[model samples]
Target chain A: MSDVSLKSMDDVYPQSAGGEVRDYFQLLKPRVMSLVVFTSFVGLMLAPGTLHPFLGFVAILAIAVGAGASGALNMWYDADIDGQMQRTAARPIPRGRVSKDEALALGVVLSCFSVLVLGLATNWLAAGLLALTIGFYLFVYTMWLKRRTPQNIVIGGAAGSFPPMIGWAAVTGSVSLESVVLFLIIFLWTPPHFWALALYRCRDYSRVGVPMLPVVKGPDSTRTHILVYSFILVAFSLAPVALGFGGVAYLIMSGLLGAGFLYLAYLVFVHRVGVEADGHAKRLFLFSIFYLFALYLVLLLEAMVPGMMVPTGFEFKV
Target chain B: MEEEDLKKRKKRSIAIGLMLVGFAILFYAITIIRLGGDVFNRPL
Candidate 1:
């Protein structure tokens, strides 16, 4: 009846496990990948030293492949829990679209290719950081902390936070305090962000025996933790402003964004699911995504436009 | 039957695309390595 063009899977044939080209792509977790690539690109841009343009591109590509590899491996290992959780139940492996062995082989291949190419293209420091990131995410986070403790996301967040540092290393062949600040911002932001999701999805995590903070500590405590981490995140957000990387525009934008973040966290903290459940936790969860993205956008903008927002007397440009 | 053929075609195309990308990256790495050690160096 409707004239809208329908893009349906009706034309496609199902494979043995219903696997498709897209199923393999899904194994890479492209949504998480966009963030990794953006942060690492910013890192490459923000570092002090110069890199050959072609080599810089090569290094970034390696980091991206490595990031995708880790994601695939995570899905491979977490397939069991993933099947139980509503949010992940339709993932390639869980949905039987891709086999575990296929995912694992793809992950290992990408991992080796990425790390070795990065070492050949750039310095080994960047390559080593990439390898460390991949290993830590797989071994330390996915295999170790995820099922064992409530602090899974808290510590495992470091694995997600390493791209900028690796990006800086890719360019300068060394790590610097500036990259550390970027790392810390993401580190402090992760707990509150993830905890908010856990607030609503606690039952799903509980059913799977995954000790997400809310399932482990209950909702009230989780709300309080969200508020607390939001505070720390606000403080960390201002660090770049003080360091000369972030200018007046960045400072003002970060300030407003941080204030908005704190307000949402407070709203989530005060509201609870009762007779009528207001979606405060969901609001906070959504806002947290916007907050991190906006902060990074402001930083990226400031870096591109040199003197537009340069602080009073301190001159900094990329 | 046509749908099945389309699916197979798609899979083959993707596999070829992935292989091409890998080969290109490999070629780039070899070129960089052969160019006198450092990426920043001016080629002789």
Candidate 2:
């Protein structure tokens, strides 16, 4: 829409060959799917009630497929920008391995299939949440907000953050404050995590005309934003412990992990320019992923291991 | 190139067939699980 021509596969590559299974699979963005599956599994396990193991597996599978459907839809819509960005240039649509129409069909079919299956297997609440996730991603984030706002990742982050809440709803058939807390953790963590990457890849985003924070507001402001969000994220990561869901292990882990995260963020904030600054930003980006994973891992472990949920002696009334 | 495209299309067909069969099985299993022993209690 922004002067970037949306070329179909035939237009770009007249003799382009058909896609293999691998290329079609790549359209789903499996790496992101894996993380979604893991977090949702953790959320399901940590919920108040228990689900049948087989049904639990089905719920996770449906959620993963739904996430993948959104990813495919996103790729279909962003093919124009995808071709311009170095990071996304090799994606199936851009590479002509898969047609944009094929991606759209796959996405739409999978979205309906996953949602219907989830509704049949579990409650409609979980299925509805899945539907909302797919819709918000495709309609709100991808179509509307991404190119228009520097806060794109900040809002688009909700799509990625919904899996755990959906998993929680699948087990309980209701939304609880605990599930909302899990959502907040990821929502707050998204800005800093993405901004760090945007800092280094600012040129790529600007070239593609995507309004990423670093591209729109410059690196200094983006660094300030990362440090601020990192502060809030670190503080909120300890909320589970206060909420009585996370154990003593989680308390200790969150404390240590928060310190490391804050230190990396501080390094990013302090180093303003040059290769040294980019290195710090990259470190923060990588460490942010590990920090969130470790925090969730500790919570998941506490839920799994019996006798591991010792009280931290301070339960605040929330 | 034509031969390669044909091969890929054939492979895609096989994948789709397998996925459809798998979907049917999964739905059947879910229906059975959700119904549980109550399914056996139904009158003929």
TM-score of each: 0.87, 0.96
Candidate 1, DockQ to 2 decimals? 0.28
Tens digits of per-residue lDDT, candidate 1, A92-146, equal 8877777777889889999998998888887889999999999999999999999
**What stretches of model 2 exceed 4 Å from their correct place?**
A1-10, A13-17
Report the Cα lDDT for candidate 1. Answer: 0.84
Where in model 1 is the C-alpha error above 4 Å? A1-18, A275-278, A312-318, B1-17, B29-44
lDDT of 2 by residue, A97-133 (tens): 8888889999999999999999999999999999999
Candidate 2, residue A147: how far the Cα is off, in Å: 0.1
lDDT of each: 0.84, 0.91
- DockQ category of candidate 1: acceptable
Worst 10 residues of 1 chain A by lDDT: A5-14
List CA RMSD, all candidates.
7.8, 1.8
- What does the lDDT read for residue B25 in candidate 1? 65
| TM-score, B chain alone, candidates in order | 0.75, 0.82
| Residue pairs in clash, model 1 | none
